[model samples]
Target: MSELIPAQQLRYSAQLLLPEMDERQQQRLFASKVLIIGLGGLGSVVASYLAGAGVGQLLLADDDRVSLSNLPRQLLYSSAEVGLHKVDCAKARLTAQNPEIAISTLPKRLTLAELQVLLPEVDLVLDCTDNASSRLAINQACYTQQVPLISGAATGWQGQLLALKPWLGQGCYQCLYPDWQDSPSCLQSGILGPLVGMVACQQALLALQYLLNIGVIPFGHLRYFDGLQGTSGQLQLQQDPDCPVCALNE
Candidate 1:
């Protein structure tokens, strides 16, 4: 890896100040490649923070277009971009935020085969998508590739975040939701705008910690945030003996 230039060092001075972060870890972040699925509320926050923090390469995938209603929680797009594709809008915003980092986009929803192909190229996967089907597909792809996954969801006053290190025989998203039925989304259930941000921030922190090897990876555990009560809790997740996706790996 190349040494950080004077400008780069100054750009990331805050993160570099941490005892767990140094030139080496900064370089690791700069060399890391992350694939983020979804460009809605959670995806917007996760992409913005990771790009701002200097994650080397980001591959954004989302087929949805920006809607006027999305402006409340999806922070990346402006009113003028209402009709544009989300991945395109996200790419533009993230690039403008950090020109030094490489940003790529797949403007269409990825099929499972496509995800499998892309998984091997990325160091980590962020399942920022809202629906159950997308999340299940992302999990299966990550499990097959043995890549780390940071999954997050927020609806109404509640939010959930989980990090899965599938290679370690840790529980995966499927272990938590065995039935792949469509669940209520923010659109139907009505979401708290700040709740998405809170979950996304946690997801970004987990991704950074995993990439930089800074702290415990939180595998097989879920963090729940209650926006209404202003409290948080953790749930110890266990690998399912019958999890179709991960049981074979274990």
Candidate 2:
């Protein structure tokens, strides 16, 4: 509920010269509160980029700790942090990166009830988390709150990014993964380190664009990238008429 932190002192050269960005858009981004549900590979980059870009406040929720295998991606921590709580370490790194922004770290497991409690205070929600249960909960929260949800997933050499804004006519995450069944994650398939960063960065861009409501167009379609052979493709995603979340009224 606090006022948005001003970005005038922290504006970077890239944002200053961007013809598409103006003071109003920058302020809107600064006023946005983005809730990131993970502290792993994708969540790490998304948090770093958004904080560096001067987002106003952050509601960080992660119930994991740094592990030996997480070294390659989760860049917010050092080797010494192998046993420390992930959200604790991430908060320290992010605050050091830009103390001007407000950060609220919740090092607790989040359920649908918890998400709904936090949903109303934020503008956008980014699901960098790796499970369908969490992603589905986030989708429902966003749809019910009329907040935009930017979702991303990565495994091996494959990556997917989609933004769901039910208030604006786009489909929710459930529209794509309706069954919402639990599936294998990077930990199971071994994701390439860089793939997580790329996917997280795209998620950040989508979140910023949605918050700014600038000239940026919503990616109504789904994007697929094959890091193996450098091949990528996208196919338009039609709104499922019977989607339980995106089209609950029907």
Q: Which candidate gets the maximum lDDT versus the true structure?
A: 1
Output the lDDT of residue 168, model 1: 72
Give the Cα error of residue 58 in candidate 1, in Å. 0.3
Per-residue lDDT of 1-250 in model 1, one digit per residue for the tens? 6788999999999999999999999999999999999989999999999999999999999999999999999999999999999999999998899999999999888988999999999999998997887888898898889888899999989999998876577778888888768768788999977889999999999999988987887788998978999999999887888998888545
The parts of candidate 1 lying over 4 Å away from their true place are 248-250
Candidate 1 clash figure, as a count: 0
Tens digits of per-residue lDDT, candidate 2, 49-154, equal 9998889898899999899999998889899999999989988999999887898999877989988889998887888787788888888888888777778889
User: All candidates' lDDT scores?
Assistant: 0.90, 0.81
Q: In model 1, what is the error at residue 158, expressed in angstroms? A: 0.7
TM-score of each: 0.96, 0.90
Query: RMSD, each candidate, Å?
Result: 1.4, 2.9
